[model samples]
Target chain A: MADLLTPENLVNALSLGALYALIAVGYTMVYGIIKLINFAHGEIYMLGAFWALLVVGMEQATGINLFVAIVPAMLLCAAVGMTVDWSAYLSLRRRLPLADGLSIGGLTLLGVGAIFYKLTGDTTHAWYSEAAHGVFGWSIVALVPVVMLALSIGEKGGMLGRSLGRVSSDRLSALITAIGMSLILQTLAQLVWGADYRAFPQESIPAWMNEPSFHLGDAPVLGKELTMWVVALAMMAGLHLLVSRTKIGTAMRACSMDQETAALMGISVDRVIAFTFLIGSGMAAVAGVLYSVKVGGNISFRMGYYPGLLAFAAAVLGGIGNIRGAMLGGVLIGFLQGFTGGTFTIPFLVMILVLLVLPRGILGEPQATRA
Target chain B: MLELKNVHVHYGKIHALKGVSLEVREGEIVTIIGANGAGKSTTLKTISGLLRPTEGEIRYEGGPIHLVQPSDIVARGLCHTPEGRRIFPELTVHENLDMGAYLRKDKSGIEKDREHVYEMFPILAERREQHGGTLSGGEQQMLAIARSIMSKPRLLMLDEPSLGLAPIIVQQIFEVIARLNREEGLTILLVEQNASLALKTAHRGYVFETGTVLMSDEASSLAANEQVRAAYLGSD
Candidate 1:
């Protein structure tokens, strides 16, 4: 308990809480628009880190520059993520109504999992090979075009928006979507990433960026932890700007408030919804990468579960559907975890206070209470 | 300015409009009268492009508008203030008015129209910031009319505007409708179960029974008709 009261613990709490807030934004955005608590969104984050690792790993394996390997790595991961949406989220969501699709999606994923484990059971001992040694040189340049293409496709009322819009309001559809999303993503992680923690070494990133420093203070301060928080804060600020100031952002807000009314107002609700998913998933992906870097480790596919839950917890703290609230809630949760984790009383007290103050989860949307 | 020729409408298994046809000439008021289950509301929905006719053509200003999205219909200057006051409850009165003129691009003109609406319904101007949900029933009804007027439609459609309103407020709303037709030269298609008020206010009337029109004549003549008075107005 005394150790937790130390300034070092406080700093750790703040940084971790900030990261939770950053990731919670993605969950909250998706929920705010569709009211879905995407269970597998955590997997999407995990997949992002793997993408970065894959690129850097391939670059090191082959005699390629860091610049060249990044392109294919991001592209491959993005394609995988998009595929996750297309094959699982879109396919099931489109085939039947929401309730039926959720059941079918779960069953189908389980069936696929059994097949995967059966096929790859013997190959578990094999090492990861460098498939693209000396692959083409491309920076994050290629990603811009791909994201733009995704934006365009989403604007055209892509499959998810079209199918879900038919059954219920955007809020209801989002909730169902998150459920289906979580299942598919969790299953994919279990099948592909396996149950082992896989990560790039600390030396993979720039040396200076990875180093931990202690300030000459009464208590210890970790520089590496501070950097992690700075990155998260930056991401949150950027997202806030993206949602508030831009044209697409305005359109997104319009869709969230009243989709049918937005459609009547000449804003294409489908396009806005698609953009929402892309941004949300993309944010989760970015968080995935940064989380790995901060921890100086690789993660199993299932790594997304704890953080996903925590991020969701943060969002609930903030008011699930409210963006600013989610961010604030995240920081609060982190601080609480930092102070009360090893000791029961303080954390328990904080949890009680939060529950009493906000029984609905920190930032949960008000309208979502109907269900 | 709007014509429905041999239009057919259905609600699930029940037919709502059995090949009903109607016309509203420019610069006039046309009212549709009927009992509870008659096709009065369906005709307005069809004309506003909310419902597509099962059979027949809907011509607007001689242009064939057989089928189109509802917003597009509003853009084409045919606006319908729907039945039972479908005001956005969460939004303020001013915001509701803004939504009414959603398709218009001219900022100055829109502001001007908003002011005009406020001038027309001073009560709305006073309650501009208040949420529609908090407003009284009569106030919400007034807001609905003001919202429709903000669209500045060439042809306005009102469905049961007088439904569930106090007698004085109903008279006030009908008076405003009459003024919009007489002074602004705005064509209107009003659907109502109140045959006396509709026929008295409108220039022409159509009597709907079940899903079809049983009689069509000048409003004053229909008001004087023995059958219309006996069956609808409860008059001698």
Candidate 2:
């Protein structure tokens, strides 16, 4: 118990909590508005780490400004998040024909992934000859239609997407589709960045951040821990204000309550939903970058799986649709994990028990409607 | 201001509306009166672009509007207050009012219109911070209308405004409706089951029965007709 009270343990726990809180904020908001769990959100976090790894290469020429990677990482995450919704989730709500996922989701998440990294020296059993090595090694214009043609080969795969969008989108079907999306994203990450573990570059960790002792006396706080807390808190505050005070925020809350009514107000429910995805995915990216910075990138295609699940547990444990509840839930779970010495299953067990006792979780609305 | 010609609509396979036609002139109060499932609501929905016509044309202000989305239609100055007072129940009254002008960009104009709506409904001003779900049924209806008013709609379509309300509250609501039409010259298309009250409030009215308009005439004439009286007004 005394070991748990140490400043290092406490900082680790808070920083972990901050990571979960950032991801959970996005996770919970997506659920709050659209009622889809977006199981692929974890892959978004993983991709964020990989994007930072790309920036590490840039640092060789551009000096050690790896933080600049956050911008492209966030933009990429936002685009992927928004595209997934437009192609996979939203097509169900409107009567429009479905399975346009490849047009943007594929181009950005998969096609763009290929362009960033070469495959010749990376993967074995290479499909290309010596002349065609590493994804054209030059032109993006030549690859667009070929990838689209590959995706459009048959409706057999699109049958699942079309049926889900066209006929029934009850919670069970939606959940299944979300799980499928999660797997597809994982595969995309595997195919693009490989399944090997990558590092966030040692130099990216500023020496000052590595130095311990942020307090006057015996209490020690690494600057990296401070940076994590500050970044997460600032983003969360900005999100809170945006949701509560802005016209766009009002429209978003309105969409969460009832979309048909929101449309009547000239609010354009689709635009608000897209904006929600942009914000939520960006928050998840911040969590990813912060985690990579702190851990020196113990990053892999599967890395986001644990953090994503834990953050989801935090979102549910706090209250699925409430923002503050999600943040608190994340912190509490982070501490629980820290004190238990990485006995991670206990958090799930706790989540199940808490959910059985309170189906809406601690801060969820009693009525099952969004707040 | 609005015209629907031979509108046909199907809700899944049910054929909710078929070959319905009507028109609403500028600055006129037009009412569609009928019993339950008479397609009055469906007609309003088709006009407001909530549902597409399977075979028909909807023209607003001399342009084809049948293909427009509901939000775009509102931006074109045709606002809809749908049935059952579907206000954003979780939003504060002020935010609910703010969303009414979602497509507008003029900051001061939105503020001015919001203040105007507040003056029209003082209870709303007092409860600006309250969630819409907490309001009384009549107050919810008021917020619904006031929300539409904030958009500065040139032609307002109301679906069952007095639904499930106290008689006195209904009277108060009709007075406001009359004032909006008279003072502001706001064109209105009201759908109501209250035949007696609707004929009184409207300049002209259409009698809808089983997805078709059985009769259309001056409101006073429609009220006097024995066939209309027996079927709708419950009189000799």
Candidate 3:
């Protein structure tokens, strides 16, 4: 027990918790606004890590400072996050009656399928078969926008529009779409990066970053751990100020509380949501880079899944929508996980126990009287 | 300053507004009185751009505003204090008020408006650091109205400000509303279930029944109408 509670383990726990807290904020913020789980958030973190790796590789060839990779990685990840929202969630939200929108999407798939068939022209011929398969590969590129336009117009005119407007229940569809997005992102990552674990070239990093900066008793604290702590805390503080003091941050809070009322207050809901994604993903990018450096310097297509789930658990543990709660939960979970030697069972049990005891989490507001 | 011509609104299969038409001239308090589902709130929502009208037009300052987004409408100085006083529960009163001035770039003007709001609802200023959810129902409503005024709206549309409040608190709210309109020349469109108080406060009144206007006239005439008195204004 004494060995487990050593200073080394405490530092490890803090760094790990800081990473989880960073990613958890993304989940919590997105959930706060739209009430969607944003299951693809983990993939954003993974992509950030990969982006950092790619940029670091460039640095090695050109002799640039490897630390400079953080900026582009964060920017790229933010763009990716925004694109995911634009392509997936926003498109569905704009279409009233998610079923109608889905059907239109289905029709577009069929249209593209037909176009592929025409291009193939008798698949019995080897050349034709290859052409058909190639066409099939590009169908999504050709058909998605076409279908979107058709449905958008249909939503604005005639009986279809009226009927579409009648179905106001979009929560279920949005949830399903979120899950689908997770699968799509995971699969795409696998296809692009393969399922192998690629080691980050730690030697390329500055020697000072890799060396121990200080010692606690027998435990030596590496400069990398110190860096992670400083960077994570700085980013968290920055986020807190941005949310609490900035105009856009205030708008985000208002939208989270009541979207229609926020809109009525002249706070553009769409703009606020987009900004939320940008900030959340940027933080996740920073977390991803730090995590890769600290944990064996390896990057994998599935690297984000376990940490992402743990961060989600951290968010829920801290009271999902409360920002401070997420931070607290992340640090607590990180310490607990470190103490337990990275076992899932203890953390999972903790989450369940916390839910059973305080269902609203630590900082959740008390239930208000229903009108 | 605002006109709705044959406006229709639908929520799923329920037609909330059926060709509801009304007008609010500059510097007037126009009240819409009705039962729970009589489309009074819907009419306010349509004008505020929270709900898009299915048919007809909403003209604000001589331009069609039916197609405009809600945020743009508020930016144009049309603020709606919505039903249920949807204040950000976790935000402090000061933060909530800050959110109200989101679109305004005039820092000094916003500060002046903030002072004016504080003057009107001194309780809000007293509890400026308290979260919105901690406030009482009456305080929340005051915060809602005070927050709206922070926007410096040209046309303020309030929905059911007295829905669930003590009679004394309700009276106080009405007094503030009347004062704002009287002193500041602020135009208002007030929706209320409290017909007697509404008619007393408004210059013009519209009686809404089952998604359409049943009558429109001067507030005193509507208060005197036998049908309106029997259906809406309870016998004293």
Candidate 4:
């Protein structure tokens, strides 16, 4: 009880919640578009952290500012994210029907993983060279605009978007695509980053900021956790603005509301869905970088899986498709997990509390129907 | 102007529309009337590009529009207000109207047109901030109609405007339709089960039975025809 009241616990709660919230939006958006929960979203999240780790590692050796290295890292991850969409998901939607695509994608991922393991010797650290780190700063800046433009073309002017324009309903094709996306990304990580637990260079900010402290009734309690809360709040605010104010954002909301109606209105439902996936995956990437920054990346291929589950749980707790609900649910769940650890029957207690308080999850809204 | 020639549409193996052909001239209120499962709605859906005919050609303004996307059809000046008021439930009433103008880029004119929708449906103006899902059925129907008009379509197709409405409310809807035709000179293709109400509202009508056209004539003649009276008017 004394530890629960400490400032460190509160801060940890906030940080974990914020991270979950960020990743959860990806799960929520994919679900909203196609009514399918993406089990592989966690792998994408892990890939993001690994990308940051790779970039930061290079910067550390090459005498470049590691902080400045983040720009290119983000761009690379975004490109990788879109590639995941195209190679795994988009191909599934185009080449074969949905069920066959899922089986093929899953099998292909397994085969690629085996090959990656054989080539890389199943080592995570060997992928990170101890020397020869050159600054890729110019290349990173040059690629950002090009990547953004490519994504736009893929979403808007691409043959996939055009062909699928009329079939605007929630589709099984989308689910198969998501599964294929998961396999492609995980395989890419295994091939490039190797199957190892690589760590980022030692940092002080997480330790210095995560120190907990509290004063209650003139008694001092120590160990504070505020950084995560601040990050989560900031991310939510930025996401709110991006979704509400942008043209693509408006089209996304319109697609969620009614695909047929949105298409008839000329909002380009396919392009909007693709854009939503891109933005949602981008958010997951940001969360990945932040996760590495705070925890000093000891990344695994499946590290994002647990976080993804928590985020999905958080998303459902608030309301599966509601954006604001996801944020609230994440924060609340973060606080719950923070306080419940090592407590009597912690898992059962948490489960009971969630069931009693939010049978639909922390932020779930009720169902709605129009006349 | 729209024309459907020898259209055959099937849902799975069940034939929903069997050899149905109809035409709507420019600047006219053309009503398609029938009993339930008479393929009335299927005809409208095929014409609007919502459902493709298994075999047929749909020509609009003298060009084939059968292969066009639904959005492209709207861009070509044909808009559809779907049955049972399929408005975007989560969006605010104003946002619902904005969605109707999704194709248009003229920001200032779009804003003005939004105001026009508000003026036409004064209740929509009052409850503009409310979600479309929260509105009453009658209001939802009105919002659906108003939202479609936001596209400024040359041809507006409505599927069953009088479904599940009070008699007084039905009268009000018909009045609005009459005013739209007279004042705005908008072409309408109305599908309704209520033959008497439809004839009163439309210039000409086609009576359909089991996926085939039974009769096509001026509304007044259709109203007075003995066979039409026995089959539809429900008068002895």
Of the candidates shown, which would achieve the greatest TM-score relative to the real structure? 2
Q: 2 or 3: which has the higher TM-score?
A: 2
List candidate 2 segments past 4 Å from native.
A1-3, A58-64, A95-169, A213-219, A368-371
For candidate 2, write residues A228-256 as lDDT tens digits. Answer: 89998998889899999999988888888
Cα distance off (Å), candidate 1, residue A301: 3.7
Q: Write out fnat for all predictions, comma-separated.
A: 0.13, 0.73, 0.78, 0.57
Task: Give the per-residue lDDT of model 3 (tens digit) for B144-223.
Answer: 99999989898999999998999999999999999999999999999999999999999999999999998999999999
Q: Higher lDDT: candidate 1 or 3?
A: 3
Q: Per-residue error at A2 for model 4, in Å? A: 2.1
Q: How much native contact recovery, as a fraction, does model 3 achieve?
A: 0.78
How well is each residue in B51-160 modelled by candidate 4, as lDDT tens digits? Answer: 88989889999999888878789898898888888878877888888888888888998889889888888999999999899998888889989989988898999899
CA lDDT, candidate 3, residue B130: 97
Question: In model 3, where do residues sit more than 4 Å from their true spots?
Answer: A58-60, A92-95, A98-169, A202-204, A368-371
lDDT score of residue A350 within candidate 2: 91
Off by over 4 Å in 4: A57-184, A201-231, A242-250, A340-353
Better of 2 and 3 by DockQ: 3
lDDT string, candidate 4, A111-220, tens digits: 65567556645444534441122113223323433433333343444655455552432244455445445555554565556555665655422344334355444543
Query: Which of the predicted structures, 1 or 3, would earn the higher TM-score when compared with the native?
Result: 3
Chain A only: list TM-scores of all candidates.
0.70, 0.81, 0.80, 0.69
DockQ, prediction 4: 0.45
The alpha-carbon deviation from the true structure for residue A235 of candidate 3, after best TM-score superposition, in angstroms, is 1.3
lDDT of 2 by residue, B53-169 (tens): 989899999999999988999999999999999878778898898999899999999999998989999999999999988898999999999999988899999999999999999
Cα lDDT for residue A331, candidate 1: 85
**A246-274 in candidate 1: lDDT tens per residue?**
55665566456655444444344445655
